[model samples]
Target chain A: MKKNLKWAAIFGSVLLVCLGVIIFGQFSHGTTSAEIYVDGKLYKVIDDLERQKFQSLRVETEHGYNIICYELGKIWVSESDCANQTCKKYGKASLVGETIICAPHKLVIKIVGTDYDKADVTT
Target chain B: MRNNTTVQKIALIGVLTALSLGIYAVEAQIPVSNIGGIKLGLANVVTLCAMMFAGRLAACCVLGIRIVLAAAFYGTFVSFMFSLVGGVLACAVMCLLIGLFDRKQLWVVSVFGAIAHNTGQLIVAAVISGTGSVLSLAPYLAISAILTGILTGLTAQRLWFSPLKRFRITQTRDGK
Candidate 1:
């Protein structure tokens, strides 16, 4: 391979990866809402939670149950009956597209704040 | 002198496999934080070096053994799947590029190989999670691959420049 071409291929691949990240970021931007899913289906969508401020919810699936706590614009799994405490131990999630998954329960909590929902000023 | 012979070749492959496994075990012990699938993958140094010292087939053999042994010793089915795919992809990419450039440019080959490895892992991650959102990590993993690849490639380069050359069989001048 030509030396110049080799260099181009290396830089080109990096550029493509960066572009992909940018596009994904733009599409998933904002964190005004949180979408909860169970077994690949939409479970619930918590929107404009700032009005209520501190909010908590319980999500129970056939596999088990989870207590999700939302406070100060952050979400976390405070309790789960699943054998693996990975979700409970995940701590806090505030970023857009961030997720807390309880695999055993097949439950997923994903941040999906759209631009119109407004960013949480308190955070 | 240990000239090119079937027994010598097989012995070299065995030694390389052992070295790769040793490095892999050590790497597995290091603590990782907020893992987005980033890894040092230092064991790849032996895989790349095997290409330079033995051949493409020998490198594949080394990587295959290392992956199987590692999975049997320290991996779950899920972890084994991830490593098997990543290791196979990385070894294949490196072997493909091994003959394209001289040993001085092994990092180029390694960079592509590492990227391929990460891509493989990312795919497995997405499939296991049953979501494409996990792909958001692609860019981050790619960047990390470049850095780690350079590190492992330079290590292999140094070994090639050292007395390790004496261990190289009298087969291909470029050693494939």
Candidate 2:
């Protein structure tokens, strides 16, 4: 029984450390761009090049459609045709490496880290 | 175990399966704030309890039936696939842990089981969506697993002393 407690404590500490890393990583990864993928392929990149304060795109295909909206540094699915609406429920994602995935539609919208946040805008 | 007649074994398995399915149904309705796909995994209590009291095969039977029936009743084909992979992985990990650790350490088994289940689901999600970004969500899922696993494991431990414990099928043949 004592040995079990010791193991539990060790596992608990490891999990706590992992949680700390994930939470810290989520908040700190400076995101300057968002990437959208459909059916495992890259579809679009949203950055300063778009020049819109707020923009919405209707991603459509034979499977379905999702209306993705983005502003400044954050992105989210404003509308979708999927039954569960998980994408919409995921709300806004702004942190670097954060993602909103719609499994039914095979769509993934992710906020990606970028070192060239400005040079990309110029080119 | 050989102590339990085939008829008794069948009856116990049926009851546990039904209970697990019912718990799963109830669990689905309770939403986790912010996280869409995350669940408390309360139904794991039944699986853990079965593994401890009944035999491994009986626990596997209960887990299998619960996954298949739940998916058939309330899930899509894709969801069923996720459940099958996750449930099988979780059960396998739990079974292995149960053998390695003392019976009093069931919570450890439950914790690892939950982590295995989440990993399986995350892999399936990544494959289906074709995004490695899904892997980023692992830490959150792991946190949930630790809490939920402890809860379900303690619940099972509490249940081990209930009148229902009589259904335990002890190994008599080879003491395996």
TM-score, per-candidate, Cα-based: 0.73, 0.85
- Candidate 1 chain A: minimum summed lDDT over ten consecutive residues — where? A114-123
DockQ for all models: 0.21, 0.48
Clashes of each: 3, 0
Q: Residue B41's C-alpha lDDT in candidate 2?
A: 88
Clashing pairs in 2: none
B139 Cα displacement, candidate 2 (Å): 1.9
TM-score of 2: 0.85
Once fitted onto the true fold, the runs of candidate 2 whose alpha carbons sit more than 4 angstroms away are A48-56, A69-75, A88-95, A116-123, B1-4, B172-176
Q: How much lDDT does each candidate structure score?
A: 0.75, 0.80
Best by DockQ: 2
lDDT by residue (tens digit), candidate 1, A18-121: 76765575466454567787876788988754454777798878877899988766778888877635566666766554566665566777766567335545
Write down the worst ten-residue block by lDDT for model 1 chain B: B29-38
